[model samples]
Target: MLVAGSASPAEAGTGQLLVHLRSLLPGLAGALRQVANVILEDPAWASRATIVELAERSGTSPATVTRFCRTLGVAGYTELRVGIATEIGRADQAGWEVGIGADVLPTDPIDRVLRTLLAVDVQAMHETAAALDLSAVDAVADAVVAARRVDFYAAGGSAAVLEDQQLRMYRIGIATWTWADVHNGLTSAALLGPGDVAIALSHSGRTTETVEMLAEARRHGATTVAITNFSTSPIADVADHLLGTSVRETAFRAGAMSARHSQFLVLDLLYLAVAQRTHERSTEAFARTADAVAAHRTPYEPRARGGSARSADPQRGA
Candidate 1:
C-alpha cells in the first residue's frame, strides 16, 4: 500500500489524520467501517473518548478498534486520539466554523452555499498538499519532461480536468493528447513505448475505463501515473507513480465535483514542475503561443488622465 509521503504512522503529522480516514472509508467494510463511521461522525468526541467508549459506541470489541487504528497507520488508540485532537485544534485555529461539511440545503442562503463550497474546496487542497509526496511528484515531472509524448485518459468529469492539463502542456510545446473515449485511449496506449508517459485521472481510482487505459499503456512500456483519491484503489496498482488527493463528498458535490480542486492541485504542481525543468524552452513556447492568439483578442484604448481616451493601434499593440 502507498503511504502518505512515505510517513510511518508515528511520523505522519496529525493534520492529515482526518483526511486519510476520509479517503480510506470507501475501501473499508464490516466492523472496521463501523469504527470509522463512529469516529468520522463526531471526531471531536472520538478524540476525547476512551478506547472502551469508542468500541462500545461503534458496537465493536476493543480488538476491532485496535485493528482499525492499525489500518489508519497509527501505533494505537492513544496516537489516534492525539491526532484527532490536534487536527481539530488546528481547524479551530484556522477559524473554520463547525458544520462546514454539512450538505447544501435547497432553502439555504446563497452566501451560505458559497461559504460551504469554498471551505470544502480549500480544505481539500490543504489536505492534498499535506499528504502529497514530493519525491513522487518530482519523479513524475521528470518522466513527463523527458517523455517522447504523453497520453491522458479519463472519463466524465475527470475528462475536463485532463483537457485542462493537455492544454497547458500543449501551450508549453509538450507533445500531449487527452482522450475521454475508451477506444481512442486504448489505441493511444497501444502505440506508447519506453519513452512515453501515460496519466489516468479518477476520483475513486476505481473507474474501469481509466484503469484499463493506464494498464494498457503500462503493458506497452510507457511510464504510467495515476492521480486518484485513494491509494488502495485499482488504478494505483497499475501505476508506476501514484498521486493521491483528499476530498470529502457532500450531498450536493459528490465524486468528481468534490474531487476537482484536489485533482487540479496535483496536476498544477506537476505542470509547474515540468515547466520549471524546461524553463528556457517553456518560456519561448509560452511567448509564441500567446503571440499566436494576440490578434484574436479585442483591442482596447487607454484613457488619458482627465482627458479623452487614446486609441491603440490594433496592428501594432493593444
Candidate 2:
C-alpha cells in the first residue's frame, strides 16, 4: 500500500490518480502545479489530450509536462493519461454524477444545500478510503499497542478528532494524552522516549503547533505519526508514519470540516486494529466501562394497554 510519506503516486494505484494529484497540489512547485491544475480542471479533456496538447494548454513546454508526469511517479505522459482515464471511468461506474464542488448559494433550498454537503462529505470518505494505506495503519497500531505512552497533538477541529481517539484509547486501558496547547504538547513530547508514540492530527498537515509538537517528539526518540490531508506537508517530514486523508473542500466547508469524516474513518480503523490485537484486555475494559456507566442510564419502560407507562420492576408497580 502507498504509505503517505514513503510511497509515490504509482504505488497508490491508478484509481487514486486524481486524489493523489489533489493531495500533492499544495506542495508542488509553480510549473508542476500549473500542469496539475490543467488536468484537474478538466480531467476528461486531459485524459484524451496528447502530451504536446497538454503542454500547450498548461502554457508550459513539453519538457515541463514530462517532468510533471515523472513527479506523479508515472513512467511518462501515456501512463499519466491512462491513470486519469481509469480514474474517470471508475467515477462514472460509481454513479458519482453530482459535482462535489458545487456551491451552496444563500438562496438555495434546504434540500439543495443538504445534497451539496452530502456529496462533498461522501466523496471525501470514498477518496480517503481509496488512498489509505492499510499496512501503514497496521504498523501504527502495532506501535501503539507496544508503546509505553502515546501523546496526541492537534488544534481546532483536528483537536476535537484527536480527543475522540484519546477517549477510545483510555477506555481500552492504553496510556494516552491529548494536547491542544502547543506549549504543553511540546513539554509532553520532550519527555517521551524511544518506547513512546506521538500522533499529530491536521487537515493540511501544516498546522505550526501540531507540526512542532510531532517534531519535538521525534527528536526525543518517540515514534511519530502524522494524520493529515496532504502527505508532503511539513508535519509529514518529521513523522515516522504518515497517514493521508483525501478531503474534498468546498467554499462552504473548510479543510477541517471536510476532513472530519475521513479522519474519523482512519482513526476508527486504527482503533479497531489495536482492539483486535488486545482482544481480551479490550473486552474486559469495555465491560468494566459499560458497567460503570450502567447505573447512570434510566431503564426503558413500556406503555400499558390503558395508555399509562409501566415500570418493568413489579416492586415499583405502575
Candidate 3:
C-alpha cells in the first residue's frame, strides 16, 4: 500500500490505506490497533458506521477517528462505509456453500507455468492449514476488536504484506500503523499506550528490527501479535497471539514472490475474520458516514462528447 505505488483512484486514500491493503509496515503508529479490533469484530457494522460513532464506541476523540480514517486511505468515512457495504454483500453471498476445488494439470509451457502457480499455492495453503493456530488467530482478531490502537511491523518481503493488511483493516474500519524502519519502529513502540496492540511479521521470525520493535511495544504495555513462519522465533514465543503461514521454499524461490503471496492470503484471512465478528459497531459508523456524504456531495458537469449537450439518459448513465 505504498502511496507512491500504482493504485487506482478508487483504491487510493490516506497514506495508511495503502499499507493497510497492500503492505504491512512503513512506520505505522500505535493508535490504529484499536480501530482494527473494532472493525474485526464486525466488518458490516464497521463499513456502515461513521467516524464520530466509531470514536464514541471506541471511546476515543473525533480527531483520532478522523486520522484513523485518513490513514486507511479512504477519502473519508463515507467512502469506506460504501466499500464495506459492498464487501458485506459479497460475504453474505459467499460461495462457501459450494464445494471448492482448484486443480490444474499440465498442457503446454503456459500450462506448466499455471501448474507451477497452482502447485505452489496449493502446497503453501496446505501447509498453512496444518501450521495455523485457531486460538491464536481468534485471539488476534479479538485483540484487534478490543484494542484502542494498532501498530504493525514488517521487514523484508513481509512489509508489502503488512500494507495489504492495513487496506483490508481500513475497509472494515481499523486504524493500523506499519513500520518498515527499524529506528522508526522503536519510536512507535516507545509511544504505544493502553488499549493498543502490536503485530510483527517475519518469515524467519528472526529479524532483529522486528523483534526489537515488538519488545518496545511490550515495554509500552501493548498487546502483541506475531505472524511468522517459525513457531519458535523470539517474537512468536513472546507474543500473546501467533498466526503462521507455511510457504515451501525452493532453489527457484528468488525475490520471495511465492512466499509473499501466501503471506498476503494469511493476512487477508485474519483481517476478514476480525471484520466478521465486529459487524454491529462498524455498521453504525457506516450509516453516519453515508449521511455525511449525502449532505456534502456537489454537482458535477455531465460527461458529453463533441462539445454538445448531454442527453438525459439515465438508463445508460448519460
The model with the greatest TM-score is 2
lDDT tens digits, residues 1-318, model 2?
233455565787887888888888888988898898899888999999999899999999899999988788888988898999988787767766465345678888998888777776777788888888878899999999999999999998889999999999999989999999999999999999998999999999889999999999999999999998887788888998988898866777788887898999999999999999999999999999999999999986777665556454567756
After superposition, the stretches of candidate 2 with alpha carbons farther than 4 Å from their true spots are 1-6, 305-318
For 30-86, candidate 3 gives per-residue lDDT tens digits of 656566556645665776677878877776766876776666556667766665565
Which pairs of residues collide in candidate 1?
Answer: none
The residue-by-residue lDDT of candidate 1 on 156-220, one tens digit each, is 98999999999999999899999999999999999999989999999988999999999999999
Q: Over 4 Å off in model 3, which ranges?
A: 1-108, 254-256, 284-318
After superposition on all C-alphas, the RMSD of every candidate to the true structure, in Å, is 3.4, 2.7, 21.7
As a whole number from 0 to 100, the lDDT of residue 201 in candidate 2 is: 96
TM-score of each: 0.92, 0.93, 0.55
lDDT of 3 at 243: 72
Each candidate's number of clashing pairs is: 0, 0, 61
Better of 2 and 3 by lDDT: 2
Best by lDDT: 2
